[model samples]
Target: MTTISAGATDPISPGVRHVKRPTPLRESVYEALTEMIIDGTLERGRHLVEVELAGMLGVSRQPVREALQRLNNEGWVDLRPGFGAMVHVPAEDEVDQLLAARAALESESARLAARHATKDDVARLKELCKVGTAYHEAGDIDGAVRTNGELHSLITQMSGNRFLVDFAAQVDRRVRWYYTPVAPVRGAASWREHNRLVKAIEVGDEDKAAQTMREHTEHTRKAYHDLQAGSTAEPATDPDPAPRTRRRRTT
Candidate 1:
């Protein structure tokens, strides 16, 4: 675990981004915290202290409080009446539901992309694949994850369906949260799969694109489960663990 401290200058971390005061504080706080959660900087099941978060972002506690409430409403935070907020530890069933949803949505997107993609769109995908493969070979996990997201997002955009793009956006972060841990394990093979998907779309082979994407997502799902099986500590469970902190009741 990285030692989180105040007034830190770092490119990437949980709360290293000190919100510039010019922006709307609450919304900025919300976005910052959400990014942290999605990127696994703030791991699931970790307690979130408002003061600490404020110190991290160099903001007042009020904005942090508001952001946590919003996160709770959106299912990213678990806010108990007595307990403070904890990053929501997703249940195994919830992970399955979201991953399954991703597979369905992305497969359809691939099919539609094959039908709608132009030469420029295919060029963009090949570029992403090139950069992504370089990152993977260089052992830059974070770079690989970022490029992987760009590639998938480009495919979704190429689908030419606004609704599909909107739907894919909703699940994108959660999908990244699940995908990050298993990325190294998937390694070069994942890029190979992406190349196959790209080829299918490039050739306007709708069925092949759809099927390739489905298999690619399924491979990620299998990797996640295999990781869980091998690990002694499971991050997710059938039923989520209870919130870890409790506020004291004062008379």
Candidate 2:
């Protein structure tokens, strides 16, 4: 994340220009803590201590408290009166809902990309598909997942719908989190499906492209359920009720 001064003219990093200005302490704290939670730095179900977070981030406890409150509202943290805040453990139902939403969005993206994609665009998609396939074959599940996301994001951009792009961006991280458990299970076949989808797009078959995406995403949804059913440590059950924190009402 690069800082931007008043007269900055250099091209900002793609997809993160909003971080240029001096961010408020509370938002900064929230963003940092959110990343930690998403990236597994703060494991699910672990308690978050405001004092420790404040000291780590070089801020006062007030900012951490405010950030935790905001995170709670956003479903990333659960706040309890006596226990304070803890990372929200994502459950199977939540995962199903998010992936269902993703399937709807990406299937449309594939249809549109087939309608609008230039030769160069198709070539790029093929390139990413190859990279993901190579990564999966090389036993680099992390690299395969990252490149797979990049491929979907690029296809979404080809749809020429900024709203769809932004909406997909919003849920992208959560989708990644749910995908982790099933990546290896879905690895080779997933990339093969990607190849088939790209071929459909290359031929400008809108219906075929959309169907391919739908099937591909549906396969992922099934893979997730199967993985959860097979895993002993999966967070399959619903979470305990989140404790409510009292907020002082202000005029």
Cα lDDT computed for each candidate against the true fold: 0.86, 0.82
TM-score of 1: 0.81
Against the true structure, what is every candidate's RMSD? Answer: 15.4, 13.0
Across 103-199, the per-residue lDDT of candidate 2 in tens digits comes to 9999999999999999999999999998987787777766877898899999999999999999999998888767765777776667778888999
Question: Which numbered prediction scores highest in TM-score against the true structure?
Answer: 1
Best by lDDT: 1
Deviation from native of the Cα of residue 159 in model 2, angstroms: 0.8
Q: What TM-score fits each model?
A: 0.81, 0.76
lDDT accuracy of residue 69 in candidate 2 = 93
| TM accuracy, model 2 | 0.76
Model 1, position 107, has a per-residue lDDT of 98
lDDT of 1: 0.86
Q: How many backbone clashes does candidate 1 have?
A: 1
